[model samples]
Target chain A: MRSHRDFARGFRESLAGGPAPQNATAQDPAEIERRFDVYRNNVAHGLTQALARHFPAIERLLGADCFRGLARAYIAEHPPRTPVLTEWGGAFPAYLADEPSLQSLSYLPDVARIEWARSRAYHAADSEPIAPERLQETATRAGTDLCLDLHPSVQVLQLLTPAGSIWASQQPGGPAPPRAKEWRPETLLIARRGISHVITSVVRSSTGRFVSALRAGDTVARARDRAGADFDLNAALLLLVENALIVGAGIETGDES
Target chain B: MTLPRKAGLGFKPEHFPAITETKPDLGFFEIHAENYMGAGGMPHAMLERLRADYALSVHGVGLSIGGPDPLDRDHLARLKLLCDRYDPESFSEHLAWASHGGVWMHDLLPLPYTAETLSLICDHVDEVQEHLGRRMLLENPATYVLFDDSDIPETEFLTEISQRTGCGLLLDVNNVFVSCVNHRQDPRAYLEAFPLNRVGEIHLAGHEEEELPSGPLLIDSHGREVAEPVWALYAEIVSKTGPLPSLIEWDNDVPDFATLMAEAKRASMILSGDHHALTS
Candidate 1:
């Protein structure tokens, strides 16, 4: 039987470029490292490629060498448990937050956070965005509590790190990603706009109203009071509707009204 | 207008756009099925474009076919979804390995070819076939170590698995070189023992060798061009195996798209070398 200790030790060694298990035969110790190097190289490069696939923006932000260095460190800190690598690196954003080397680029964690959302949105459930008929029925329910069900692929990321703009400027056809200080910490609304994932900077004026209304299924009027600002109800509804992220909605007749 | 069957290249993300842009005439393309399992995204969209233009193969690296634990249901379901989506020309995975006992290793781990392991692998292969609703070709594994108590040779074990499961075999020539050198066995013996009739695909990869004080061990790194010895073995296998659907696999340190196609072209010439002379 393969002991847990032996497996763990071998795994660590494999990650660290050390000797693999001498389980096969009493061969030279150097032989273990020599042979193990292939697996080692594979593990590192495979994960690196997977990471790059997951976060193409990050790969572009930090050139290949820097990305490789970041990837190597991330691998050392969080080795992958599943062979299904597309979903690996779930903890990388958190890992980025604590990485001292990234402290200089203080908003790097938020960038990673946004990148991870892109990964999740890319693979999230495939559901029809809110159909027009459903939205009409919900709005027409007489004397009932209105509710809005967000699209499964929708994510509302609240970061104080100015990442939404960073994500945008980095888009393939968009202008080159703006430099630091060109933008400030802000909120973002990301949704799978068809097959493409789109990130938009949540205008400072509307961020508060959108988050509360979207999450709590609040009445449009009630949501306005909560934010206490001139929220553009027309533009707000258009944002959700035009993007086709409004998947499900309902109205409760027997509420505490 | 179409890709040949002699030898193909494994397509990675970096080469996706270029391959489409260049429209090179080569053999089919192979991709890991699991990578394209998402509902609909870049991999599938691009793959659709490629599929429209080329013969395709969907090779899997994570089925965990010989482990002590139950096979992963979710992974299998997703793989099935991919198979249904792509309806690939050929599909294949590794032999002599099991990654998951409970948690998956992700990397292919070794199994001793004992009766217990053989039964276990057959069970897993059966499950894979039942779930995918189609037979998958099994590739031989590259190894770093060998167990003393292994009762059967890896090829014989693979042959038995193929015979029992009715699955095809994917003969990876580089793995033959790596395992033979690491275990100090004759590569030719392995080729001789392999059930050539069952072979449905061929794989060529580069391996790195490091000499030890005891003996040198060749690692199936797949990070370089096909080694000379491995190329020689590929020639032998192709001549015997008779123009199988071969792939040149360079998964790491992937060079520009042209480099991969160049290597695939080399394998194509070798496979169809009745008229072409060996490179001097």
Candidate 2:
């Protein structure tokens, strides 16, 4: 039987797409190389497909061939460690953000990030959606420093460009995305309302204020207040309502305090 | 009771309607456990409808059974839950590979069958069987490369693990052909010494060969029909093990159900008079 140490050693070598057949004759190194390349190709292809599935918008923006080549290179450098394809390529957006070659495509990284968030939201576990009436009840409770629970599948990402618009433009029948002169960081809430992830643009000011307030552990009203002079309660509330993002809130009653 | 000694097909959600309507006399249907991990969806709904008529086996592709890292605890838990849900006629996983290191690779990777590998994999199988409170079938891997560090032959390693862990085998005939041809070993020699009595299931799939300047190397692509030579090996295997529950595995560019069924018919033809000693 092969020892655990040897087993581990062989695994390290085999997994790296290394020279497995040490006994290959000089006359046929090319044959062994070609045979082994098939395995490498399959591994690379599988990871590329996973990335494509995870970042559909990025693939679409780059066109099929270019995207595939980039993905192939990315996979060879960073193969997934886990077997769950859903969890694979979570770092790909950051990778794209750091790639020197992709430096020219400044807007590309943000779009990839948005796409990754959408993929996560699409597959995240289902959570209960707090009913609108729950808010009304919380509103009535005195000294209730209301804090709402975000959905498990919900991700709020702030990006440098209108990635939502860019992602939209690449879809069938959509216009090309407006250039970065339209470049202003936008907040997006990606969440699974019922079955699939739904993405919508959140006003930048409200997003920053909301995140800051949430970090400070303040009430919803206090967070909205942080949105500064231009904070529009009606618009933010309407956006939350439309997206079905408000799960449930707990009032910080004085008695609990 | 042992699974019937007949050929079966891997069940895809797309084939539920036609399979149920036709009620082909397959030995069993195998499904990837991960695909059915959803709480309630079309895959489950269709599987529930189909399981009412066909014997079902759960084949897990994401268990990461032979990884250097400890067996994925949550993955094992989830698989245990699935086993409880399906109460499948049988269950199996691969012996040759680990896909995910921290994550899943979604493909079966090849592992060297060293003593260490034997013990590690045996432990994994033991844990799985303990969690599910039943025996689990472990399948051999087909490989394009042979690790220089491998000290034991594949069959010996598998047999030793089976002996120690009390797990059964899911022998893939095409894998034997592919690996044997790739490594220049006798496919018949591998089969002749195989522990047929402990083999709970069999798998047959198609492979393709790319001719290089040095020689022809077989790739276990499973994208087409099982070749004539592979069928001959299957016949020889069945003649020994009698017959085991067999599946026609086609994961890439899967064709229509009729195509799979037709391929299955060829396997079924070989099982006409055979019977596994253990089950039959």
Candidate 3:
């Protein structure tokens, strides 16, 4: 009798296109092979469908056949580590980035990153946005030492291509996003707003730097200094407030001055 | 909490507006527990609104209850939280394993029906029930292969698990048809031996047929309407067990809300003993 552990191990191997387990039972060898094929197909198809659902932009960019081929390779290499299908494709962006054949489509990986972040933001825990008065009070009392805690769903991604625009253009009814004429980098802020709505914004590089600093627990003064003299601090603050990205704000307890 | 002995449809996001606005006469709405595991989102908001008017069945697809590894504590905690939030009328999981060594296969793989496997499943079921603070139903899997080391029948294995763990059975009629046809066994015999008295729910789903050299392989794709033979088996089970909380599941290529509701209406008519509806 095979141990359950051995059986699971063998079964997983078989489903990944390996030979059928020696202990697999069927009326005949031919039947066993066919059964194995069915299992393999089911696993492959299920994972492919999941990937397609999560990364629609990538699928749209690569077309269905190419995407399916890529999905098969990705599934074989990185079978899900968790039973949560929603959380299955975390490593896909990195996988695509590392693929030699996909190097030409350089923006594909960043688009995947944006999609993954959107998924995370969509399911992230809900929280009450920080009241504008609280932020004002912190700004008045702490001046440059103010630090803001972003919402749990807030995510920032800095990409080397206009992937954010590309993703937005592919949305169901979104207008055609302007094409990038040069190798210009873009930064995006993704967060959930007003109950269940997910919102994403492409930000100026300076604002992205400021937000990144604030997210890293830097005080307002330090973040501003890092964002450089040209950074419009008020505009960045307004953007965060309007999007309900900041969840809490307080004075920096430690002296970083 | 128990659901009404009528037919229901698996809840999908695309159909939420129709379900809410029209308020279809569904006995209950079944949702995949994993889909609602997120802390807060549209899924929860929609479910909350629907919960006001419909009984809910929290069906889990990733508990991996039949795996060799120990039950996943984090996953169980999340499931418990969801159950507490929804207060669903019923909770259920599959009998086949989907994960091992911290890697989830994303497909329900068959387990060897041995003493060791049976004991493990019973323990896992017990853990889930105790943690969730409610009894759960275990659904039989649609398996494509059998293990050479198996010593017990599938029905007997499920019966023993239920008897030991005090869990209820979720007899998926489509699975019965798919598995029996794949294994070249009699579907009726399997149903006859199933402990129908212990059943608390029934699942109906569509399957696809794949032709191989050996024979026609039925895949439990759940992407189309329920086949004729599966419907017959379901009608047969209903005759013996009377009306249970049956669910019509269409996960892939899901048609419009009206189409799914139509399927549910069909099941409801059957459950209500309007045999004419099945023919019509």
Candidate 4:
């Protein structure tokens, strides 16, 4: 008589390609083994489906059979920690980066990263965008000392390859951009503007640096400084305001004496 | 908490536009709770529009209610938030577990029917209902393997849970057929013993048959149209239950909206006692 805990442990082990537990009930031992195999297959297949759903672009890039094989290996290595299937593949991008055999597709991991970011942005918490007047008032009050809070769905990605464009090309109705002759570092900004809408844009490296600094809680002047002399702070600020990406803005008036 | 006694279709994102445009005469639309758990996005927007038109049923697939560990409170809170947002007419989850020790197994796994397992599931159901501030219907699971320590029958197990937790049953006829075929039991007998009076909803889905060396194993794939045998079984159960809210569930290999509507129409005819459709 196995305890429920013991049974669950055994069952999970079997699903992960371990030997079947002796307690599985059936008319015959062979039948039990055969049925357990079906159960294992289902578990594997279901996880594979979940991973495939999250990484559709990766699947398109790698082809179905290749992606499935990679997904199986990935699943075995990093089973989901949460019951939420949508939140299951957070580690896949990093996992792809570590896979030795996939060295040829150097951009695969970054593409996975962008896909994961898109997924997070799509499902991220909803927030009311800061009104333009409020942003302006804060800007006036603190000038260089003003800090801005981006929406919960905002994601800034800096990649060594054009993975963002590659992912966009895979999207429906999106024409594939010609592959760059040389590796060009790309910066991507992703955010959800509407309940079901996600907006992804390729931005200049300066804009990405500025947004990243703001996201790190830097004041407007500090963020602009971090973006360097070439960065267009006003244009970046306009972009953030127009897109409703900034959810909160505040001024730190320290000891007005 | 009641849905119209007509057929409904599982809502899929791919058919969102068509469904919104046509507004098919579905009694209600059911969606997996996990799919809509995201904070905000198109899924919620579309669901908002659909919720305005149709009675919604939140069918949860990842609650892991029968697991060894305590219920995931965060997941529960999220589920509660979604239910509160939608005010769905009904909410349901499967009898099986999909998570153990914080690791989520994507497929619903079976557990032995014992005092410990029964108590565990009853506590989970209680927690879920209390957290959601509503009664939930628990559907029977499709299992390929049985446990040696299971002293109680599946029906009695479910009956005890329902009686103890004061929850309704979600009788998935396809699951009954698939599990019975896999376990070499009679589907009709399972349905006979089922507390159909307590059934709040019925699920009809397609299954795939995998030939094993031992015998034919039925997998509850839900990727195709309802098979004839499952349909007959559903008709038998529905005839007994007198048209419980039934849903056509096509989760994988999902066909176009027209195919789903046609299937829903078929179920609707059966629910309406139109024997002509059954014969056709």
Best by DockQ: 3
The local distance difference test score of model 1 is 0.74
Candidate 1: chain B TM-score equals 0.94
Give interface RMSD (Å), model 2: 4.3
Candidate 2 chain B: 10-residue stretch with minimal lDDT: B271-280
Give each candidate's interface RMSD in Å: 3.8, 4.3, 1.5, 1.7
- Lowest-scoring 10 consecutive residues by lDDT in candidate 1 chain A? A3-12
Computed on C-alphas against the true complex, the DockQ of each candidate is 0.34, 0.22, 0.70, 0.68
- Tens-digit per-residue lDDT, A27-77, candidate 2: 345565666676666766777877887788888778889899888777767
Give the 10-residue window scoring lowest on summed lDDT in candidate 3 chain A. Answer: A175-184
Q: Once model 1 is optimally superposed onto the true structure by TM-score, how far is the C-alpha of residue A40 displaced, in angstroms?
A: 4.1
lDDT of 4 by residue, B81-156 (tens): 9999999999999898888888888788888899999999999999999999999999999888888888999999
Model 1 CAPRI quality: acceptable
**How large a fraction of the reference contact set does each model reproduce?**
0.36, 0.29, 0.79, 0.78
Q: What would the per-residue lDDT of candidate 4 be over residues A218-257, giving only the tens digit for each residue?
A: 8888888898767987789888877888899898667533
Q: Candidate 3 residues A159-234, lDDT tens each?
A: 9998888888889998686655644778898888866788879988788889889889898788998987669988
Stretches of model 4 off by over 4 angstroms after superposition = A131-142, A172-180, A255-257
Worst 10 residues of 1 chain B by lDDT: B96-105
Q: Write the per-residue lDDT of candidate 2 for residues B52-106, one digit (tens) a residue.
A: 8778889988877787777777778878887887788888898855553464445
Predicted candidate 3 versus true structure: per-residue lDDT over B1-280, tens digit per residue: 8988999889999998888789888899999998887777788889999899999999998989989999899999999898898899999999988899998877778888999999999999999999999999999999888887889999999999999999999999999999998888999999999999999999999999988676778999889998888888888889888999999999999999999888888888788778786686
Candidate 1 stretches with Cα past 4 Å from truth are A1-19, A26-30, A52-81, A98-106, A125-151, A165-184, A200-202, A208-212, A215-230, A237-257, B1-5, B18-27, B96-102, B209-211, B214-217, B275-277
